[model samples]
Target: MAPALSDILRITSSLLVLMLLMFCMGAINLEAQVGNLAPDEVEALLEVATQLGKRGWNRNMKLCNNTKLPLKPDADNEVVCNCSFPGGTCHVVAIYLKRQDLNGSLPKAIEKLPHLKHLDLWANYLSGNIPPEWANTTLELLSIGVNRLTGKIPGYLGRITTLRSLNIQNNMFSGTVPPELGGLVNLENLTLSANYLTGELPQALTNLNGLKELRLSSNNFTGRIPDFIQRWKQLDTLEIQSGGFTGPIPSSISVLTSLTDLKISNLLGDGSDFPNLESIAGIKYLYLTWNMFTGPIPDWINERDARYGIDLSYNNFTSEAKYRETLNLFKSTWGGNYSKPVEFLIVCSE
Candidate 1:
């Protein structure tokens, strides 16, 4: 019993419609998965807000759409966004919650922010070590200093090659600076001061050829300052006050012709004459205190009128008269106990 032609045609039409409907549904699912700002990331943001004590944002509110909403930010709380997707979806790009006294563990959910580049939580009360999940982002500036964070700085941070400025000073980070950090070829400014870090500077750090400024003051490090610092040809400012290192300034440091500011205080071992700074044509500030330096103070200190300020107090210089003749110890606090980052642009002189 063959079915009638019209019935067969009708059945085929229904089946084709059903198939088309299924295909459309699958396409919609794929779009939701790959196109818009990911749902998981939004959820991650909510988790971050919850952990960070930010109670303003909610899930139903669109992050990018509600840009004009008054969120009553305090203590530099901010959440930057970018919304140029085909369907107007958005992405979190940066989160600056500095000076907020946020007392919580750094959430692992930060890895979900695919477009995030900056995450500055400096001067917070946050505790605990940095989560390994943070390494998954493309961060450029990661400043978390002046916090109560503890534990060893993970070597995985070196994997964040995009980092330009990394300031983890004034924390309780222990252990040695990871040698793997040499992988950050683009890193420019690095501050690891006021930590409980020990051990000599890793020789692998010579690979930071692009380094601009480096601060390692107030640490419990040992051994002589490595001569490998000559590799930092682009270095502008170098600070090493009370770093628990002994011996003279590496003579090779004179090769850093780009240096504008130089600081090395509280050396426990032997010291030599003023470093050869004739190559540094534009030297500005110099802080060389509490060291066992010998010999006469360089007369060139006055020769460079462009020199902004110079501090050579409490050193064992042989020529007491000359040391006093050409010195200005009036720029900063005692022992280089800087509570925050310094501004090098504005030079202070006597």
Candidate 2:
């Protein structure tokens, strides 16, 4: 009968190529068990550890005080918090156990932990905030810094723009400062220091221009410090202390030649001095102490260059002998003959 109909069409084409190679090996073993811990993610992590062991939660202490809980990553049933190795310098790649202290809230099945990145629950006493579906995933590092986090810092976190590092510093984050965080242009490190952040200063954070480190100190920020803040030319550290900055400090900020550390101390109050700060000739650690600076302590503060460490003690400097001749010319050109003051700390002790 025509050779049994060509052997039943070559045995139905070899059982359809062995059922398409067993459906591509079961779709690559469900994409390598999608980083394991399945079974409805361990039944939603034992139903969030049976609702935090029914409140008396203490699955082995260490909840704060440099917090610990991350250490496990062999895959399988997941739940291996943080397994560091000599490899990727691991920081919670899969199950960080989101905003720990499993009290209440946040368990909408945890959006099914699709390889969480790092969700440190800042000062957690975790309450309700930031759960708009967690802006839909793909986190790198999101600290709820000093929690009690009220609303408004989450404009969907600008969609987690490949966040490098972000800390919602000392939370209770009030309105503003979310100029969409400049869409996290690969943020290097940012902390909205002491929140309650107000308007201005968030022109999308000068578009983050790849900030190196910026902390908008003790917020309530007003305007006029933005000449694009010298475009953060790889800025090393610039803290705008107790914001409400009026004007005049921008002598183009000495073109920010990789600012070492400059803190414009306690804004416009007690003798605020910013008269071009001797052009910060590569400031080493200047903190223009308590503001409202008036005149005389700036003949370049006796022409500083003594590897710099000027504090300009409590402003309105009437030059106590020109601040003791600029601390004896920074203890004689940064080395000191006055009982070894090589690293000066002139507080004017007032």
Candidate 3:
């Protein structure tokens, strides 16, 4: 009787082990499928396609199949998926539909793509303001530049704390920048250039200590260039040419040791000394044109590999013997004005 009982127990144990192995294999197979696309995501995608005026998306095939919906260069409609969810559920992680000329509104259904991190709609003719429903998303990068997006940028955008890059340039967005944008502490690139935006920059912008590039040119803004820019210790590029800002370029700029390209011009303020850019050895391109900077030419401009990298045109720099000597031939063309109303424009870097 004891031998019979032992045999039955061993048999039962073996069956249990076999069952466990089969379950694991099933799990592995599901994982290998890159997580089956979730039903809600598919529905949301359908809505997205409808809103974007794209008629070619086939609902029958797996959306996660990269061969069918690629995320490569120049691909008109791209959807990237992340399949790391529990139970092998896949979710859309990114969407890029650039240069499509899709005459559609910003899709409110985009909020349903919950896991989406990046959304780019560049070079499109999309109309209307950003949908408020988008504030609920956790997007990291949002690029809608070179589009026909119109209306004031919504204040609700600040609620998206996960954002790292917010580009809305080359649009028809008017009105002052909402102070709420200052809430994006993780922001690295903020491009509001080439818009009809006006009003003073909010003091709240000082909170973006991690900002690297800020371009706010060709706008209708009216205010002093804020001094709080020194707070951005990681800054590399800053462009505000014809940005409608007044006052001297803040001397505190010297504290930004990481500056590489600094372009600021058209200040509506009194004459000031040259901004101290000596500490920034990695400086590549410097453009400070159409201002009233009255002083002797600083060596920092000449210190780089800049045979033609600095554009100090229409300023009031008294003298730089070396620069004058290099451009001595061009001087004869300018009739030796010496640029008390200094005029300069350097060719773009090679």
- Winning model by TM-score: 3
Model 3: per-residue Cα lDDT over 217-264, one tens digit each: 999999788889999999998989888998688888989999888889
TM-score of each: 0.78, 0.34, 0.82
Clash count, predicted structure 1: 0
Candidate 1 per-residue C-alpha lDDT over 194-270 given as tens digits, one digit per residue, 9 for 90 to 100? 99999988988989999999999999999989999999999999989899998688889889999988888898876
Candidate 2 lDDT for residue 224: 61
Residue range 1-350, candidate 2, lDDT tens digits: 36797798899999999999999999975444333223454455555456333243343432211114443322222234332333312222443443444444434444455556665544545545677676676766776566566767778777778877787777677777667778878887887788787777666677778787777787787766778877778887777777766645666777777777777766643333446755546666777555656655656665665655666554554443234333432222112123423345633210
lDDT of each: 0.77, 0.59, 0.80
Ranking by lDDT: 3, 1, 2
TM-score of 1: 0.78
Residue 330: error of model 2 in Å? 45
Q: Estimate candidate 2's alpha-carbon lDDT, on a 0 to 1 scale.
A: 0.59
Model 3, 80: alpha-carbon shift in Å? Answer: 0.3
Weakest ten-residue segment in model 1 by summed lDDT: 64-73
| lDDT winner, 2 or 3 | 3
